[model samples]
Target: MKQVHTRFPVMETERLQLRKIEVQDAENMLTYLQDPDVMEYYGLPPFVSAEQVLDEIAWYNKIFTQQTGIRWGITLKDEDKIIGSLGFLNWVPMHHRVDIGYELNQEYWGKGIASEALQAVLAYGFETMELERVQALIEPANLASIHLVEKHGFLREGLLRNYEYGNGKFDDLLMYAILKKDFLASSK
Candidate 1:
Protein backbone atom coordinates (compact mmCIF):
# COMPACT_ATOMS: atom_id res chain seq x y z
CA MET A 1 0.00 0.00 0.00
CA LYS A 2 0.98 3.65 -0.32
CA GLN A 3 2.55 5.48 2.60
CA VAL A 4 1.95 9.09 3.66
CA HIS A 5 5.28 10.78 4.24
CA THR A 6 6.16 13.06 1.35
CA ARG A 7 3.55 15.59 2.41
CA PHE A 8 0.95 16.08 5.10
CA PRO A 9 -2.61 15.52 3.99
CA VAL A 10 -5.18 18.16 4.76
CA MET A 11 -8.80 17.17 4.41
CA GLU A 12 -11.98 19.21 4.24
CA THR A 13 -15.57 18.25 4.83
CA GLU A 14 -18.79 20.23 4.62
CA ARG A 15 -18.21 22.08 7.87
CA LEU A 16 -14.72 21.22 8.96
CA GLN A 17 -11.11 21.15 7.82
CA LEU A 18 -8.57 18.61 9.03
CA ARG A 19 -5.10 20.12 8.78
CA LYS A 20 -1.66 19.64 10.16
CA ILE A 21 -1.22 20.42 13.82
CA GLU A 22 1.26 23.23 14.31
CA VAL A 23 2.97 25.02 17.13
CA GLN A 24 0.51 27.89 16.84
CA ASP A 25 -2.25 25.44 17.70
CA ALA A 26 -0.87 24.64 21.11
CA GLU A 27 -3.15 27.08 22.92
CA ASN A 28 -6.26 25.87 21.15
CA MET A 29 -5.30 22.24 21.76
CA LEU A 30 -4.66 23.02 25.41
CA THR A 31 -8.24 24.17 25.82
CA TYR A 32 -9.77 20.77 25.20
CA LEU A 33 -6.81 18.76 26.41
CA GLN A 34 -7.22 20.40 29.79
CA ASP A 35 -10.95 19.80 29.97
CA PRO A 36 -11.71 17.00 32.35
CA ASP A 37 -14.90 16.19 30.53
CA VAL A 38 -13.09 15.89 27.21
CA MET A 39 -10.24 13.78 28.55
CA GLU A 40 -12.29 11.53 30.80
CA TYR A 41 -12.23 8.60 28.38
CA TYR A 42 -9.10 9.73 26.54
CA GLY A 43 -6.82 7.52 28.69
CA LEU A 44 -4.57 10.39 29.69
CA PRO A 45 -5.11 12.91 32.45
CA PRO A 46 -6.16 16.41 31.50
CA PHE A 47 -3.15 18.40 30.35
CA VAL A 48 -2.12 21.01 32.90
CA SER A 49 0.34 23.16 30.92
CA ALA A 50 1.20 24.60 27.56
CA GLU A 51 4.40 22.57 27.61
CA GLN A 52 2.39 19.40 27.64
CA VAL A 53 0.29 20.60 24.76
CA LEU A 54 3.40 21.49 22.81
CA ASP A 55 4.75 18.05 23.40
CA GLU A 56 1.50 16.60 22.19
CA ILE A 57 1.70 18.65 19.02
CA ALA A 58 5.26 17.53 18.58
CA TRP A 59 4.18 13.95 18.82
CA TYR A 60 1.65 14.61 16.07
CA ASN A 61 4.48 15.80 13.86
CA LYS A 62 6.77 13.01 14.93
CA ILE A 63 4.28 10.37 13.98
CA PHE A 64 3.71 11.90 10.58
CA THR A 65 7.40 12.28 9.92
CA GLN A 66 8.08 8.71 10.93
CA GLN A 67 5.33 7.57 8.57
CA THR A 68 3.64 5.66 11.33
CA GLY A 69 0.52 7.86 11.56
CA ILE A 70 -1.04 11.26 11.15
CA ARG A 71 -3.08 13.56 13.40
CA TRP A 72 -5.03 16.49 12.07
CA GLY A 73 -6.26 19.50 13.91
CA ILE A 74 -9.98 20.01 13.45
CA THR A 75 -11.12 23.51 12.55
CA LEU A 76 -14.11 25.14 10.96
CA LYS A 77 -14.04 25.92 7.25
CA ASP A 78 -13.53 29.61 7.87
CA GLU A 79 -11.38 29.41 10.97
CA ASP A 80 -7.88 28.31 11.85
CA LYS A 81 -8.51 27.71 15.50
CA ILE A 82 -8.55 24.05 16.41
CA ILE A 83 -11.60 22.79 18.27
CA GLY A 84 -10.45 19.18 18.26
CA SER A 85 -8.18 16.63 16.62
CA LEU A 86 -8.41 13.15 15.06
CA GLY A 87 -6.51 10.67 12.93
CA PHE A 88 -4.91 7.28 12.51
CA LEU A 89 -2.40 5.90 14.94
CA ASN A 90 -0.44 2.66 15.05
CA TRP A 91 -0.60 2.56 11.29
CA VAL A 92 0.91 -0.57 9.75
CA PRO A 93 1.31 -0.23 6.01
CA MET A 94 2.36 -3.82 5.39
CA HIS A 95 -0.69 -5.06 7.25
CA HIS A 96 -2.88 -2.31 5.77
CA ARG A 97 -4.40 -1.33 9.10
CA VAL A 98 -4.47 1.40 11.68
CA ASP A 99 -6.15 2.53 14.86
CA ILE A 100 -8.26 5.68 14.96
CA GLY A 101 -8.62 8.21 17.73
CA TYR A 102 -10.20 11.62 18.26
CA GLU A 103 -11.24 14.25 20.80
CA LEU A 104 -13.35 17.40 20.52
CA ASN A 105 -13.76 20.49 22.57
CA GLN A 106 -16.63 19.99 24.97
CA GLU A 107 -18.21 23.20 23.75
CA TYR A 108 -18.59 21.72 20.29
CA TRP A 109 -20.05 18.44 21.44
CA GLY A 110 -23.25 17.31 19.69
CA LYS A 111 -22.60 19.66 16.81
CA GLY A 112 -21.58 16.90 14.35
CA ILE A 113 -18.06 18.27 13.99
CA ALA A 114 -16.46 15.00 14.95
CA SER A 115 -18.57 13.10 12.50
CA GLU A 116 -17.60 15.35 9.64
CA ALA A 117 -13.93 15.08 10.49
CA LEU A 118 -14.13 11.31 10.82
CA GLN A 119 -15.66 10.87 7.39
CA ALA A 120 -12.88 12.84 5.76
CA VAL A 121 -10.13 10.95 7.56
CA LEU A 122 -11.65 7.58 6.79
CA ALA A 123 -11.84 8.44 3.13
CA TYR A 124 -8.18 9.37 3.13
CA GLY A 125 -7.20 6.22 4.96
CA PHE A 126 -8.96 3.81 2.67
CA GLU A 127 -8.56 5.59 -0.63
CA THR A 128 -5.21 7.30 -0.44
CA MET A 129 -3.39 5.20 2.10
CA GLU A 130 -4.86 2.02 0.64
CA LEU A 131 -5.69 0.65 4.01
CA GLU A 132 -7.71 -2.49 4.49
CA ARG A 133 -8.88 -1.92 8.05
CA VAL A 134 -9.34 0.88 10.52
CA GLN A 135 -9.88 0.09 14.15
CA ALA A 136 -10.90 1.89 17.31
CA LEU A 137 -10.40 1.00 20.94
CA ILE A 138 -12.86 2.96 23.01
CA GLU A 139 -13.68 2.97 26.66
CA PRO A 140 -16.87 0.99 27.18
CA ALA A 141 -18.42 3.86 29.09
CA ASN A 142 -17.92 6.32 26.24
CA LEU A 143 -21.38 5.97 24.82
CA ALA A 144 -21.06 8.97 22.57
CA SER A 145 -17.90 7.64 20.91
CA ILE A 146 -19.43 4.19 20.58
CA HIS A 147 -22.43 5.72 18.89
CA LEU A 148 -20.23 7.77 16.58
CA VAL A 149 -18.27 4.78 15.29
CA GLU A 150 -21.42 2.72 15.00
CA LYS A 151 -23.03 5.44 12.92
CA HIS A 152 -20.15 5.13 10.47
CA GLY A 153 -20.66 1.38 10.01
CA PHE A 154 -17.98 0.03 12.31
CA LEU A 155 -18.86 -3.29 13.87
CA ARG A 156 -18.14 -4.15 17.45
CA GLU A 157 -15.58 -6.93 17.70
CA GLY A 158 -15.71 -7.66 21.41
CA LEU A 159 -14.99 -6.32 24.83
CA LEU A 160 -11.34 -6.03 25.74
CA ARG A 161 -11.54 -6.42 29.48
CA ASN A 162 -8.94 -4.36 31.33
CA TYR A 163 -7.31 -3.64 28.03
CA GLU A 164 -5.74 -0.41 29.03
CA TYR A 165 -4.16 1.01 32.13
CA GLY A 166 -4.33 4.72 32.28
CA ASN A 167 -5.27 7.63 34.52
CA GLY A 168 -4.21 5.46 37.43
CA LYS A 169 -6.47 2.51 36.74
CA PHE A 170 -7.24 -0.38 34.46
CA ASP A 171 -9.95 0.41 31.96
CA ASP A 172 -12.02 -1.89 29.79
CA LEU A 173 -12.28 -1.01 26.12
CA LEU A 174 -14.64 -2.12 23.41
CA MET A 175 -12.98 -2.92 20.11
CA TYR A 176 -14.59 -1.80 16.87
CA ALA A 177 -13.47 -1.99 13.25
CA ILE A 178 -14.49 -1.34 9.67
CA LEU A 179 -12.79 -2.84 6.67
CA LYS A 180 -12.37 -1.27 3.23
CA LYS A 181 -15.10 -3.45 1.81
CA ASP A 182 -17.41 -2.49 4.63
CA PHE A 183 -16.75 1.20 4.17
CA LEU A 184 -17.18 1.09 0.43
CA ALA A 185 -20.35 -0.94 0.69
CA SER A 186 -21.77 1.50 3.21
CA SER A 187 -20.82 4.41 0.98
CA LYS A 188 -22.76 2.90 -1.88
Candidate 2:
Protein backbone atom coordinates (compact mmCIF):
# COMPACT_ATOMS: atom_id res chain seq x y z
CA MET A 1 0.00 0.00 0.00
CA LYS A 2 1.07 3.58 -0.60
CA GLN A 3 2.29 5.27 2.54
CA VAL A 4 0.16 8.19 3.64
CA HIS A 5 1.72 11.52 4.50
CA THR A 6 1.04 12.99 7.93
CA ARG A 7 -2.34 14.71 8.05
CA PHE A 8 -3.46 17.87 9.78
CA PRO A 9 -6.58 19.50 11.13
CA VAL A 10 -9.11 21.68 9.29
CA MET A 11 -8.09 24.47 6.91
CA GLU A 12 -10.01 27.39 5.49
CA THR A 13 -10.23 29.94 2.69
CA GLU A 14 -11.79 33.35 2.35
CA ARG A 15 -15.13 31.99 1.15
CA LEU A 16 -14.78 28.38 2.28
CA GLN A 17 -14.33 26.54 5.50
CA LEU A 18 -12.68 23.21 4.65
CA ARG A 19 -13.14 20.71 7.38
CA LYS A 20 -12.37 17.04 7.65
CA ILE A 21 -15.12 14.86 6.26
CA GLU A 22 -17.45 13.51 8.86
CA VAL A 23 -20.08 10.80 8.57
CA GLN A 24 -22.68 13.55 8.44
CA ASP A 25 -21.36 15.01 5.21
CA ALA A 26 -22.38 11.90 3.29
CA GLU A 27 -26.02 12.95 3.00
CA ASN A 28 -25.38 16.53 2.02
CA MET A 29 -22.63 15.58 -0.43
CA LEU A 30 -25.14 13.44 -2.27
CA THR A 31 -26.88 16.54 -3.54
CA TYR A 32 -23.66 17.50 -5.28
CA LEU A 33 -23.05 14.03 -6.63
CA GLN A 34 -26.66 13.23 -7.48
CA ASP A 35 -26.76 15.84 -10.18
CA PRO A 36 -25.96 14.16 -13.51
CA ASP A 37 -24.60 17.29 -15.11
CA VAL A 38 -22.33 17.99 -12.14
CA MET A 39 -20.93 14.48 -12.28
CA GLU A 40 -20.77 13.85 -16.03
CA TYR A 41 -17.17 14.89 -16.39
CA TYR A 42 -16.21 13.72 -12.96
CA GLY A 43 -14.94 10.17 -12.66
CA LEU A 44 -18.17 8.95 -11.14
CA PRO A 45 -21.71 8.91 -12.50
CA PRO A 46 -24.81 10.29 -10.85
CA PHE A 47 -24.98 8.63 -7.46
CA VAL A 48 -27.64 5.96 -7.23
CA SER A 49 -27.98 6.01 -3.45
CA ALA A 50 -26.76 7.59 -0.26
CA GLU A 51 -25.00 4.40 0.69
CA GLN A 52 -22.33 5.00 -1.92
CA VAL A 53 -21.62 8.45 -0.52
CA LEU A 54 -21.43 6.98 2.94
CA ASP A 55 -19.00 4.37 1.78
CA GLU A 56 -16.81 7.04 0.24
CA ILE A 57 -16.97 9.18 3.33
CA ALA A 58 -16.03 6.22 5.45
CA TRP A 59 -12.94 5.61 3.39
CA TYR A 60 -12.03 9.28 3.43
CA ASN A 61 -12.35 9.48 7.20
CA LYS A 62 -9.81 6.71 7.51
CA ILE A 63 -7.56 8.30 4.93
CA PHE A 64 -7.69 11.59 6.79
CA THR A 65 -5.99 9.92 9.71
CA GLN A 66 -2.92 9.43 7.61
CA GLN A 67 -0.21 12.05 7.14
CA THR A 68 -1.07 12.02 3.45
CA GLY A 69 -3.48 14.78 2.55
CA ILE A 70 -6.47 13.08 0.99
CA ARG A 71 -9.71 15.04 1.01
CA TRP A 72 -11.84 17.69 2.67
CA GLY A 73 -15.50 18.60 2.66
CA ILE A 74 -15.86 22.10 1.24
CA THR A 75 -18.44 24.25 2.96
CA LEU A 76 -19.35 27.84 3.66
CA LYS A 77 -19.01 29.73 6.96
CA ASP A 78 -22.68 30.72 7.14
CA GLU A 79 -24.19 27.65 5.47
CA ASP A 80 -21.54 25.19 6.68
CA LYS A 81 -23.23 22.52 4.57
CA ILE A 82 -20.84 20.54 2.43
CA ILE A 83 -21.51 21.97 -1.00
CA GLY A 84 -18.34 20.49 -2.52
CA SER A 85 -15.10 18.68 -1.76
CA LEU A 86 -11.40 18.90 -2.68
CA GLY A 87 -7.99 17.47 -1.84
CA PHE A 88 -4.69 15.83 -2.72
CA LEU A 89 -4.26 12.10 -3.27
CA ASN A 90 -1.76 9.63 -4.66
CA TRP A 91 0.83 11.49 -2.68
CA VAL A 92 4.43 10.93 -3.75
CA PRO A 93 6.44 12.79 -1.21
CA MET A 94 9.74 11.56 -2.63
CA HIS A 95 8.97 13.37 -5.85
CA HIS A 96 7.77 16.46 -4.03
CA ARG A 97 4.49 16.34 -5.90
CA VAL A 98 0.93 15.15 -5.42
CA ASP A 99 -2.34 15.00 -7.35
CA ILE A 100 -5.09 17.50 -6.63
CA GLY A 101 -8.81 17.13 -7.32
CA TYR A 102 -12.08 18.79 -6.38
CA GLU A 103 -15.81 18.96 -7.20
CA LEU A 104 -18.61 21.34 -6.26
CA ASN A 105 -22.39 21.44 -6.39
CA GLN A 106 -23.63 22.49 -9.78
CA GLU A 107 -25.58 25.32 -8.17
CA TYR A 108 -22.27 26.82 -7.07
CA TRP A 109 -20.53 26.56 -10.40
CA GLY A 110 -18.80 29.62 -11.93
CA LYS A 111 -18.89 31.33 -8.57
CA GLY A 112 -15.05 31.11 -8.18
CA ILE A 113 -15.25 29.09 -4.97
CA ALA A 114 -13.14 26.40 -6.56
CA SER A 115 -10.31 28.81 -7.22
CA GLU A 116 -10.36 30.13 -3.68
CA ALA A 117 -10.30 26.64 -2.23
CA LEU A 118 -7.46 25.63 -4.53
CA GLN A 119 -5.30 28.59 -3.61
CA ALA A 120 -5.57 27.83 0.06
CA VAL A 121 -4.59 24.22 -0.49
CA LEU A 122 -1.69 25.20 -2.69
CA ALA A 123 -0.42 27.51 -0.01
CA TYR A 124 -0.76 24.77 2.54
CA GLY A 125 1.11 22.32 0.37
CA PHE A 126 3.98 24.66 -0.21
CA GLU A 127 4.28 26.12 3.28
CA THR A 128 3.11 23.44 5.68
CA MET A 129 3.77 20.31 3.66
CA GLU A 130 7.07 21.78 2.41
CA LEU A 131 6.27 20.57 -1.06
CA GLU A 132 8.26 21.72 -4.05
CA ARG A 133 5.41 21.22 -6.49
CA VAL A 134 1.75 20.24 -6.81
CA GLN A 135 -0.10 19.04 -9.86
CA ALA A 136 -3.66 18.79 -11.07
CA LEU A 137 -4.56 16.22 -13.69
CA ILE A 138 -7.64 17.71 -15.29
CA GLU A 139 -9.71 16.32 -18.11
CA PRO A 140 -8.76 18.25 -21.25
CA ALA A 141 -12.34 19.29 -21.85
CA ASN A 142 -12.69 20.51 -18.30
CA LEU A 143 -12.10 24.13 -19.17
CA ALA A 144 -13.49 25.26 -15.85
CA SER A 145 -10.91 23.30 -13.91
CA ILE A 146 -8.19 24.29 -16.32
CA HIS A 147 -9.00 27.92 -15.72
CA LEU A 148 -9.08 27.41 -11.98
CA VAL A 149 -5.52 26.06 -11.91
CA GLU A 150 -4.35 28.69 -14.35
CA LYS A 151 -5.84 31.48 -12.31
CA HIS A 152 -3.87 30.15 -9.35
CA GLY A 153 -0.61 30.30 -11.37
CA PHE A 154 -0.30 26.65 -12.29
CA LEU A 155 1.45 26.08 -15.61
CA ARG A 156 0.35 23.70 -18.31
CA GLU A 157 2.76 20.80 -18.26
CA GLY A 158 1.28 18.54 -20.93
CA LEU A 159 -1.48 16.12 -21.72
CA LEU A 160 -1.60 12.46 -20.90
CA ARG A 161 -3.96 10.79 -23.35
CA ASN A 162 -6.09 7.99 -21.98
CA TYR A 163 -4.77 9.00 -18.60
CA GLU A 164 -7.75 7.64 -16.74
CA TYR A 165 -10.56 5.27 -17.61
CA GLY A 166 -13.32 7.33 -16.16
CA ASN A 167 -16.92 8.33 -16.92
CA GLY A 168 -17.21 5.36 -19.29
CA LYS A 169 -14.71 6.61 -21.83
CA PHE A 170 -11.07 7.29 -22.63
CA ASP A 171 -10.26 10.54 -20.84
CA ASP A 172 -7.26 12.69 -21.67
CA LEU A 173 -5.79 14.52 -18.72
CA LEU A 174 -4.21 17.93 -18.97
CA MET A 175 -1.43 18.34 -16.44
CA TYR A 176 -1.21 21.69 -14.65
CA ALA A 177 1.44 22.32 -12.07
CA ILE A 178 2.96 24.99 -9.81
CA LEU A 179 6.49 24.88 -8.50
CA LYS A 180 7.33 26.28 -5.11
CA LYS A 181 9.37 29.05 -6.64
CA ASP A 182 6.64 29.85 -9.12
CA PHE A 183 4.06 30.00 -6.41
CA LEU A 184 6.20 32.32 -4.29
CA ALA A 185 7.12 34.40 -7.32
CA SER A 186 3.52 35.16 -8.15
CA SER A 187 2.73 36.01 -4.56
CA LYS A 188 5.46 38.66 -4.47
- Give RMSD to native, each candidate: 1.0, 2.2
Best by lDDT: 1
Worst 10 residues of 2 by lDDT: 1-10
lDDT tens per residue, model 2, 1-188: 24434544588777789888777778899988899878877888889898999988877766566645578788987887999988887666777788888999989998888888888888888886778889888887788888888988999999899988976788988889889999999878
Among residues 3 or more apart in sequence or in different chains, the pairs in candidate 1 whose N, CA or C atoms overlap within 3 Å are: none
- Measured with C-alpha atoms, the lDDT of residue 23 in candidate 1 is 95
| TM per prediction | 0.97, 0.91
RMSD of 1: 1.0
Give the alpha carbon lDDT tens digit for every residue of 89-175 in model 1. Answer: 999999999999999999999999998889888989999889999999999889999999999999999999999999889999999
lDDT of model 1 at position 30: 93
Stretches of candidate 2 off by over 4 Å are 1-7
Task: Tell me the lDDT of model 1 at 158.
Answer: 99
